[model samples]
Target: MQQNEFAIWQEFDPHAKAWQTLNNDRSRNIARKLGIGDPSTARECLDCHADAIAPEMRGDRFQISDGVGCESCHGGSELWLNSHADSSVSHNDNLKNGMYPTDQPIARARLCLSCHMGTADRMITHRIMGAGHPRLSFELDTFTWLNPHYKIGEAWTKRKGEWNGVRDWAVGQGVAAENLLEVLTNKSAGWNGIFPELVLFDCHACHQSMSDRTWGPRQGTGLGPGVVRLNDSNILMFRHVLAPIDKAAAARILEQTRGLHRATTQSRDATFAAARRLHATIDGLLPTVAAFDYGPDSLDTILSSIEADADRGEYRDYAAAEQVAMAAQSVVVAFENDGKVDSEKAAQLRSRLDTLYATIKNEDSWSRQKFRAALAALRAAAP
Candidate 1:
């Protein structure tokens, strides 16, 4: 019923009078796994693309095919699909004629990063989750090498497409987490659409540990396997990108990497514990800078509060609490910003923050409820 409901990338090759084949079925499987109802439906895929416009009217040219399209990453088969058998059309000719946006390795990385990277073309709304879809991640060569996600058989490999060999998919070269973070950190780059610093931790850093028994019910405690190892190969790559800006962070990263390899190789579990602690610390620090909204506290208040707490110079005791409070406040503000001034979004933000605050710790003296009330008033005043 949606627009472009029938716009799937049909596998049919007109010249051969048969369906074009994919060596691996991962794409089809992922579509089904996403529970999109009908894998063949074009609208479903479009829903995840630029074609799924918001209620707000925008330029008519904003097509969903601009992102996440089969042809967007793969080649547009319109010409080749129908004309490959004309004898006049060679494979190279088909490539020349097709509209494969992600033909080169770096370009392919960029194409996936368009949404996954969470830096480019993000639509902002004032909701607690921020506007638009959250960014995923990118691992250029690694991505193409993912047999479960993409098919890189001889047919695909031999083609001059975006995928480099799987071996090149290592942590070093491609758009790992670190690379995405660099693009995101640059305010001039316009990657502020997604929540900040989320890219710091790997997906498993949150998702896997979320299912762990040791994770408990702590708010913002992080959700995943709680691995102590530095899973954020992206952050390593990010450090390289940011090295030009913050020498301290760069040096610290190098030090951490050296230590991390030793820890991981020694006792994986112990290393995971250390990594979890480190991740928690960094995770707490990131939200303030990423979204830059701290609800009733404001950025100045939040930073001042943290600095004031840290000024006590007691790293072990109450100082850590102060840092956590500041981080929590920042998170609350981010949620509020995500909700914007919309009634529904406001309610969602309020609920998430209140719940997280309650579960994180029982510092009843902080008066989070009072703070929530004040933010509610501000939301009512916002235009």
Candidate 2:
């Protein structure tokens, strides 16, 4: 059963093929333009594309072809493999023997974000994106559901506590938000040459067509045209999570987030200061967010917040819209799972979700007006 699950995961895994694909024509073309030759063996590319480990750590049986193998996520099995087989051993004992504590939502999220959100060990820079790498985006609960290899039955829950998607989503947001600030403040990881790593900013800010002249001003920032904004998608989503439990904290976070955006148009020092303040605010909320149980009322609050943001033209940008879609899906699914939505209502909500998802399906053809309309319709149809 374990072997079958592993095969299934690997079959659909992007990480498994990262190395081979990096050597393909498309990646090579981009790499050539960026003066990166043969990314298959390039240290910069290999660090993420292939299994990155020290020479001594990789045994004779170890192969880069395994990609992100069990050891990659679960840690080296040598210490726990024998003891783990004995039924007499406790789960905690296995963990103590070097198994990763992925059963914990926050720990799992941190591990996933190390590569997905980038870290001091593996930083995804502007140059990598310039070489045609896709922008990084992660929501732990959503990703886990999409690629579930293990069933969380009673036996599973006995080993690991009850799995909560809402809790995972909330924890993920805080972790991701914290990671963004860490990268921004870190002198070595944040900067490349003189620029402040524009990749950390919204991709759509500078990627949009020159001919599209429509610019709806946001009152929150009061910023004008041609100003790059920080990618606050995670922070924005995190606010929704906080809204149900602590309205005051949510409002404060929203204010700080807007302040951070406004600071971007000013000096570098201003941006850093604003980011630090906002980061501290989010960091402080982690304990409450991790502990709070998301019930029906909580789901409603989050969904309501998402709708409010949409109405305010916050989802006009592709990055923000994408995050909104994920947030809406997460809340709706949680509501359904908790029996907050009946079968009939679930059907209706699912249809509305499909419409919302369709709006952002095609990035090139994304219409803000159409998306807003779809979102408003979804909000109206919500139970």
TM-score of each: 0.34, 0.94
lDDT over C-alpha atoms for residue 204 of model 1: 33
Q: Which candidate tops lDDT? A: 2
Query: Mind giving the per-residue lDDT tens digits that candidate 2 earns over 1-383?
Result: 23356776678767667777876888788778778687776667777676778889988898876767777778888889777656678889999989999888778888888888788668888788887887887888888788666677887787767777888888888888888888887778877777887768888878888998887876445567888877878888888888888889988988998888888777778888988998899889998898888876777777788878776767656877887787778877887888877899999889988998998888877988888888787777776
Off by over 4 Å in 2: 1-3
Against the unseen true structure, what C-alpha lDDT does each candidate score? 0.38, 0.80
Instruction: Compute the lDDT of residue 46 as modeled in candidate 1.
Output: 41
RMSD vs true structure, all candidates: 21.6, 1.9
Error of 1 at 374 (Å): 49
